[model samples]
Target: MGRKKNQAMSVAETDREFVLGAAARLFRQKGFDKTTVKEIAEACGMLPGSLHYRYPSKESILVDLMRLALEQASGSLSEAIKGECDPLEQVRLGINAHLELLVGGSDKVYVLLFEWRSLHGASRQEMIDLRDRYELLWSAMLKSLSSQGLIRADVDRDLLRLIGLGALNWVATWFNEDGRYTVKDIGDFVWAVIKDGVIKR
Candidate 1:
């Protein structure tokens, strides 16, 4: 019985992943305002009416996409923090993982960050809450570093968190794998500014 239950859970997980991936790509290419259920269905190679079987509405797809993105970001951060006790190194790893996602999952990250507000009512609020939770993880990590005297005493935790997130968020707009700076280079550069400030040592 337990084995059967586990298999059922695995199948459900796979199905949700498929729906979220399709929605993420469509939303990123077309923007949430422009993307429709029919378009997503076509992208997934399903009939227009078939999407309704998996998602009740286009808004639901947006919500699922945002949720999946957040989940991935959270998992990345959690992995980075594991076995690393140094606050500064943890912060560096967090930023690196975030930029990697922004570069690799650019389309989905773009949609999650920019088009999430298009969801209405409860859906919008739920996505916002999930986003806030993800942001709080970074904020908390920064705050912990400050308390340990690793970060500058004058650095504002909230402002630092915002700058880190804002910097990484823009990667989807301007990042090029062939560009002058690699993803790690960009992540390190942003971290240096956030950690040591622009002023000379």
Candidate 2:
């Protein structure tokens, strides 16, 4: 009986991922406001009613997708900074991880970026909290840099973080997947400007 229950749970988990992946693609292509439950259902090869059993409403699915996107990005950044003590190297690793997250997971990241207005109430706050946690990683790194005299002591930590993350997030808007710069190259360029401008010579 326990084995049967485990198999059932596994199947449900697989179906949920399938629906989320399908919804992410549709949300990116059609815009969250325009994508329909029926379309998502079709994409997942399920009936509309069946899709409802998995996700009660389109908004619910979107909230989960955005949450997942943020979680993945946070995980990427945390992993990139593991065991790194150099503040500048940590910043570089963070930039590279973030750019790679946007490029490699464009579908989910686009949903997170472009569908903010579509979210509301608890779901919106949840995403914000997750985003704040990710930003804190940068906050700590910047603080360390300042304490170590690598960053300008006069710099406002909050504003510095705002500019750094804001500029990095903008990469999703214009970065060309097939263009000259790879993810690491973009990270290098951003870090170069940041390092030269702020780091003590």
Candidate 3:
């Protein structure tokens, strides 16, 4: 009986993932605001009521998508920088990993990046908390650089992080997966300007 119950739960989980994947494609094609739960149900070939039973609403699916995207992104960067000690190089590695991950999962990242403003109430705050955890990785890197006198001690660390990471984060807006420059090349280009200004001579 336990094994049978586990099989049933696994089937339900698979169905839930299918619904989320279908919604992600639809959300990518249509902006989050333009997407509807019925549209997602149609895409999934499931009854609208069935999809609603799984997600309750389109917004709930969106929040799940965003949360999953950010979690993956954070994990990618953390993995890329593992055992690396040079702060500037860590930032560059992080930037490269983030860009690659964004393009690799562009559909989900697109929804997370552009549809954030559509979220409301607890959903919005929950996403923000996850996002903050991701930003803290950059924050720690910057703080370490400052401790070593690699960057200007007088500059506000928070503002420097804002400007530096802001530039890196915006790559999702214009980066081309098929472009001549690879994601790492783009990261190197951005870091060239970033490192020259901040690294202690």
The residue pairs in collision within model 2 are none
lDDT of 1 by residue, 1-201 (tens): 999999999999997888778888877777888988888888778997878987888888888888888898898888878898887788889888888888885466778878856878899899879989999888888877777767766667788677768768888788888899998888878777765672223
> Positional deviation of 159 in candidate 1, in angstroms?
1.7
CA shift of 145, model 1, Å: 0.9
lDDT (tens digit, per residue) of candidate 3 on 1-201: 999999999997777667777888888898888888889989989889987887778899999888878877888889999999988789788878877876675677778888888899999999999999999998998888888888875678888778876676687778776888778788788788777776667
Evaluated at residue 74, the lDDT of candidate 2 is 84
- State which candidate has the highest TM-score: 1
Winner by lDDT between candidate 3 and candidate 1 = 3
Regions of model 2 farther than 4 Å from truth: 1-13
What is candidate 3's local distance difference test score?
A: 0.83
lDDT of 2 by residue, 125-157 (tens): 988998899899889998888888888877788
Q: After superposition, how far is residue 151 of candidate 1 from its true place, in Å?
A: 2.3
Ranked by TM-score, top first? 1, 2, 3
Cα lDDT computed for each candidate against the true fold: 0.81, 0.87, 0.83
Clashing pairs in 1: none
When sorted by lDDT, best at the front, the candidate numbers are 2, 3, 1
